[model samples]
Target: MTARNNSFDEQAVLHELKQFLPALSPGKTFTYRNPLEGFQEQTFDDALRHASEMLGYRTTLSLEEYRSLYNSKRVKPGVLEKVLVEKKGAANTFEWQDKVLMKKFPAAAESPSKIGKLRANWQKQYKTDLDARVHPRLFRILGNYLDHGVSDWKFPVRGKGFLDSMREVESNSFVSAFNTPRARNLLLQASSSINDLLTVIVGDEMLFKQYLFDQQFAHRGWSGLVATLEIGREISPNGSNITLRELIVFELLLEIDVLDDRLGRHWEPLSYRLPAPPEDLFAPVPVGEKSEVLAIWQEAVEWSYYEAILAELRQDPQNTRNQTGTRVTETTFANAVDSLCIIGQPSLLRSVTAEHRAFRHGYDFSLDPNGEMLEEILEAVVPSLGVANLECFFARTGLAGMDDILTDQMIGLLGLADTARGDLQAPLPAGLTKDFEPMRLLCVVEQFPETVLEVIDRLAVQSTCVGRRSVGRRSIALWLLNEWVHLVVIDPVSRELRVLKNRKMITYKSAPRIVIEDAVH
Candidate 1:
């Protein structure tokens, strides 16, 4: 019991291993498992019976601490007997050629939705849901990620890595199949979800080796999603292979180059718009047009604009004294260039790949090859986030040919943040709305951490979890983080980003599937 005789022995275990050495064959294995119950019931007899000689011959005791008496053995006397009875009963579930345990789509349930619902229902009906604990595929995936990082998660090509990740997901009893017509429709509508589909379409071996092998990114989950999308397009071979919908999405994507949310910057904007999308938004830009487009992270804009307002108010204190008539200077366009280039690449000249390589030594970029593509993306997304500083920044710097960036909300937030600094007589810029909602949430936490419990109580009704119908506070934090890390606005002295978004208070609950009937009233 004191880590001596009771301790399991390795030398004796090796000796006991000799007993099965002669019998191992094509199908025989020392690590025999009850193939159907998942990875839960794996075993070998001598492996257990043989004690570690390191224990010096003391009795090996195996006891249920809850029970009064003790036994000097690893397991109960009847566990193997009970297991054998079940195995004999399960003979019908397998065949010489097919095994449920080995199959990709096993008969765990009629559907994926049923997987989770059944567990919930079974727990209610039978008073116990033991399946919650054990699942073969999922555990392996989790173990692979936790210990070895994401690199080991690949499956379906070389080995069982993909199968393992899938299994782990299923074991949660939370995942549902693309079951039901509605669920299928949802997946189709989620064309923006390029990352999820990448996993399904790509060869498993490629993914495991490329993205997972390196832990360069903070959240492997997010990084994997971005990298997957970038890699998935090449796998398809065809002038006429993929569906019309996929082609359309891909075409649109090509017209406007992407600045992945992964860049970790805040896009500056003011307020939300009812969104009468611009004409060019629907009309795809010509394939070979040269344009200058800025891919600014959403929050970085907020930080940038907030600071600009600071220098303005500090220098002229009275111009914005009345919030209405103060217009931000075009200097922001130049400052925007300065701000963006600050975080850019200590120097873009250091790296110039085909993707980011500006055609003509970064001309007005208005006529450069990369410019035309980025123009469409920036124009399309900028107005919506309402970061006018970015819009103004873009056009002012000639990143785009047209479109002023100043929007009502971004200006208002900038004004408000400046006002807060002036009002609190606290020397920091102030920052609201659904767009700023996450920022506001973060601001509150930084100023007052203790109120987190109370804050979640309010967010429960207001926020939605990621991948859900409504956006939750946590998703906002993730979205905010993309910008927080980039828009490096320190206290300028203490060198700390005082504004931090606390996602801790945000809860992540799986989304509920619902059937809806759309009709014209």
Candidate 2:
């Protein structure tokens, strides 16, 4: 079916969109097909093998990680027993338990008993998995494609436009047999328009369909949003979903940033572009508002990280382990921050402290002459994420005082320019372990007054989903009034996020509940 638009081929674009649908749909909907549609007919083990063999996707647990989990009793005997019973009953009990599990967790034949060598082998084998197999250059670009909010530095590309940067990435990417002349031609042709892109990118439509079975698994969340956009659902103001066309514009802007960074050239912003100007694509970030818009997007991305980790903490409590080796049931900034890559905002850090203090002790809001008490409490509730964010913010602002806590991982990752790597004036805190510095910093935030836990409890009670469920991803719900837009789900639960299909006044207490499809473990 062709859209009303004359310039682009709608049917082809829709076909490409089908490949990009999210693998995991929110449980708000009824039973959905597994994302790995091609391998759906196969058993779990067979599917893992097929996926890896066909797509080079490392879909199964690494043998090394599996062995560690099995030895540590993290993969409990009961679970294994249940799986064995479900699969083979009592027929091949001994062989299944000993030989089968052993085969699954195969050790490198050359260094079966050598820990260091096995680790090295696993790292190399897994590093070359799936995404990398998609043509090493595409993999590197995808791996290092840092969003503006996620990293301070831009991609080191000398491209003036999206296609140009892609060309640069193609040139620098690891060359392999997969990147054939045909593939190169396809990439080049795809950039002409949405129609050409869809038709050309998926070369030999039938063959490409087999190889690129599920694009959603390629990048779950973002691709999921793209799928949602294709479905023509009503987007809440806070919904991160944007049109495919708009995404193209954003990609162009990102490439412009890369060029500007590398060549120190002032490229025109999207708004100034004539003939299909980007301003017509979406809400254009004005020249003056660019910084503020970037800041807000950065904030949203940060909160997404925070909320995501919090969800994991709530759901995967069994996995959370600290330096002292205790199970952490409650949210910890260190755990949350460590699980994610993006840095937090200084302002959010301060707000969390103030909110906690007010919630812990019944404090009158209007009576405080200044936010002095809030500041003191802020010092107490600043998590390791907050500290990292502060350090990053300080580095960008040319301020100092966090050099001692900077881990080797961070120093190597950030690769801060000398001018940005400001000096630390304060003495190193005694007893800070190199690996567990985040944990030590977390100790300070842990001491702050409690309230977020209670908030979690309230959300759990209010959640529409039945039985025990750990929260999953939460998103902002954008509601539009006559002409203005407002955020409805300021602190939304997973269920509320799902139910925000359209925009309207949301009464948190009286919202209609959708039937629970599956409990988020």
Candidate 3:
């Protein structure tokens, strides 16, 4: 091969190649390093795109994987909403929500690297498999050259760089890994510089750096090992000296030799077959709808966990400390008890008591106390009885002559009647019945003829008692007055009165009634 004027910066290409290689030093203790340490100065999204487009690496989980997390509730709705709001602004929350939850998008295809396309043509255009033929031998050779301590015998030329050592061994050995003599001759006679070999193989000086990147990254595991060992001597205890430049040069020589053996010595460089130079590997990756969708889901998944942590941190310090097992004081215990009473227990008890009362009242009034014969009589008389007839019946029954009383005051009398009746059966404690005046009045009212009157004059409208027969404590009477049917119930044991008008119960404290007169009107 003849030397040509350099059209590219060889040192710059080598320096950039070092940046893309694995930076982790191999030793007894494992250490971590960013694979894209080269793009450290770039934004996270930029670095991710570069790694993906140039190296064919996946930087984040798949969209479906994130969607599965959402289904499992590992990604919370509130957290996702907040994340969307932060990313897209509150105005677009609904827009983004629909996109993430309902919209469907196809997965983005992996972008092919620039140099990958160049090498792939050999298999597409011709039946030759360059990677299949070259990678195995190239990896084996690179692996032996950069062996840390795994080899039984160390490489012969320890400190002399990779190409020098490989050439020395190939020249001396009777058996060789190469298929052709041209391969051996190239290794022995070729300049150690990567640019010299690229001039022969690539021909296009502009594509030299990209070609090197493509070739090295095809076997990046071995390439990275060589690159790692080259930069960091302390990575291996034996201190192997190697450079990425030497690895690239030798790998190119192997490719050329393989092409000669497979196709012919006359085969041209990859540049001759190309329509145009390959795209820049480090160019900005284009953003599409798929990436946007993935980005939204990715942020949502991450924020799901972070939101929970932030919520806890934002809580009241005292409450947070208590939750973490702080001692409870008497005041705190009392406060908790008060809160339980106010929020949890009293309202529940009130609801249950009201329901029980309604049920009991409904059951007590479900049946007619007087029997089916009187039901037929009242049902027949109810339609014919007018307000004049009802007023006359009230007058004859003596209910119209009673003094006026407010509904609340009438209810108070019923309560007193209940107490007085209970006292008659079981003697009250001495002070509990200090005054029996209300009790005396209740007994007087119970003895009135109107309390048990059954028949009315002229109209023949007999008031019939109705109540639950199973519970014999209360007695009810049905009165037909014009269009209304009134049920007046008196507890037999307590003599307490309650009215159900038009089949609905009314609050005794609020509803006003003129006793028999209201029914007449």
TM-score of each: 0.18, 0.27, 0.56
What is the full ranking by lDDT, best candidate first?
Answer: 3, 2, 1
Quote the lDDT for 402 in model 1: 11
lDDT (0 to 1) per candidate: 0.23, 0.30, 0.46
lDDT of 1 by residue, 160-184 (tens): 2322333344445444322223323
- Worst 10-residue stretch by lDDT in candidate 2? 475-484
lDDT of 1: 0.23
Clashing pairs in 2: 56-130, 237-478, 238-478
Tens digits of lDDT, candidate 3, 1-521? 22235578988878788777643234311212234446544544455555556666544445666676567555566666766765679999889777776677754555443436666656765677877788767755655555654444456666666777787788788867688887678788855467667766777776777777777666554556566656544434444566777777778778877888988776776677776655776667787555666667655553343232223222332344436443222110110000010001121122221111111111121143433333344333332232222222222212111111212222221233333332211112223422211100000011112322332122233343222111111111222211122333333333343333232332111112111211100
At residue 352, give the lDDT of candidate 2. 36
lDDT of 3: 0.46
Best by TM-score: 3
lDDT of 2 by residue, 61-161 (tens): 33443444345433334444444443347686455556434443223244221112211221243232323233233323332342222334345553233
Give candidate 2's error at residue 126 in angstroms. 28
Best model number under lDDT:
3
> Which segments of candidate 3 are over 4 A away from where they belong?
1-6, 24-32, 108-115, 148-159, 190-192, 235-239, 315-521
Output the lDDT of residue 255, model 3.
82
